[model samples]
Target: MNAPRTVVTDLPTRIRRAEPSDVGALALTGAATFLESFAGILDGRDIVEHCRLQHAPSVYADWLADDAVAAWLAETVSPPAPVGYAVIAPPKLPLDDLSETDLELKRIYLLSRFHGGGVGRELMNHAIAESRARGARRLLLGVYSGNARALAFYARNGFVKVGERRFQVGGNIYDDDVLALDLRA
Candidate 1:
């Protein structure tokens, strides 16, 4: 009897909880997507170092150690796969001190190869669902002001401009805008 062939196209690309085995691949995917997604918007050195330091094994290990952190990694059955990932966590601040209206969409990124393929929307859907499940009434994120693509994508996903802050990376200064989405409505 012949074994059933696995069809890559039939494999679902939905987001799910990330596993330890996904560390290396996910980091690389995040780094690639960051550089490719921000090519013209950020300084080359800044991007590279950001990925190196932020996506390093230790960083992911640390993230995994956080009990409150939840991440979803996108995958397909195809060879050389893995399309994207998103991470969400409750606000690190005291909820009592702040309003009940706050949650954080920590990160959502995809490989350049998967750009404009609805992968991002799928990830956002998962994140929003998770946040809603957790009783969060709002979602917020910060993006580099120079990263127009990310800003547009966030806006398209229902986030609105809330405010701005200064961020520095690789010795380069940048202005970042804060965006938020009210989930209760």
Candidate 2:
């Protein structure tokens, strides 16, 4: 039997700056989106362990408490459920000439069910706008090499390849392409 697909476009969602009180929501959304995005590309055990530590609520609380960090959460209006999120912090990508004004787009994760309904793009726009407002002249991010959809998203948003790094997830390491966006443009 075929089930009806939910029309994400009809779902009302709002993107807002994440506060300290949103740690739990951000953590849950982050882990859920990460798992859904990488379940097929990454090992199950690694995904579970990685999410347990990296997506912990404490981690998000720390980010929210940091003046130098910024995060935004997207949530449905009626049910008040998180659908996506984005976070930016000081530049973490490997580069010899990174400036003090550069910032990193640590992540922009949206649930797969929200794909094609502009959630990802809205999250990215929030990241970019927040970065620029914070005086960042450039923005950097690392994306897994195998995520063609993510790669295309970044490319469409004016990000260009700058370098590569080995990102560790649990006990495994994967190649990631570092991309940068010139905010001065």
Candidate 3:
């Protein structure tokens, strides 16, 4: 009898709540992923300044310490690396007829290598669940209007474009599409 071959499946990446101790890694990953995704769309100086101000470890440390903010991180087991992260908090942009229970999906970014590997989906699901658990009736997010891949991903996950806003990076202004999903529906 011929020996039978065993089929193996890759283990799922781990997603968990990020802690203050993770600020350093989160900042690095945030800068790397942001540049990977948007560098071509922004000027080199703009990208550098944006990363320095927004993705600095001190900024992440502040976010991690905020009681109202929530963050989740995704990690691969094979080599043990931070592959993705998500941040959720109260909405910053004004919406007409806003509800008291609305929350914002401030950001969700993943390493390009991890794209299409279900890590983004897992991180999104975690954010949605956390928002719902905290009594949020809806979740909103702002994505770069030119980022078709992210727009499509958000759409597939129940987000619908509801408005537009200006996003500033350094001295450059870019249009962003605001998307929202009603969690109570």
Q: Which scores greater on TM-score, model 1 or model 3? A: 3
TM-score ranking of the models: 2, 3, 1
Model 2 Cα lDDT, one tens digit per residue, 129-160: 98889889899999998888889989999999
How displaced is residue 181 in candidate 3, in Å? 0.6
**C-alpha lDDT of candidate 1 relative to the true structure:** 0.74
* Model 1, span 72-144: residue lDDT tens: 8887644536778888876543223335557788789876555566778889998898888887878877787
TM-score on alpha carbons, each prediction: 0.83, 0.94, 0.91
Where model 1 places Cα greater than 4 Å from the true spot, the runs are 1-12, 92-101
lDDT of 2 at 114: 79
How much is the lDDT of residue 163 in candidate 1? 72
**lDDT of prediction 3:** 0.86
Assess candidate 2 and give its TM-score to the true structure: 0.94
lDDT of each: 0.74, 0.89, 0.86
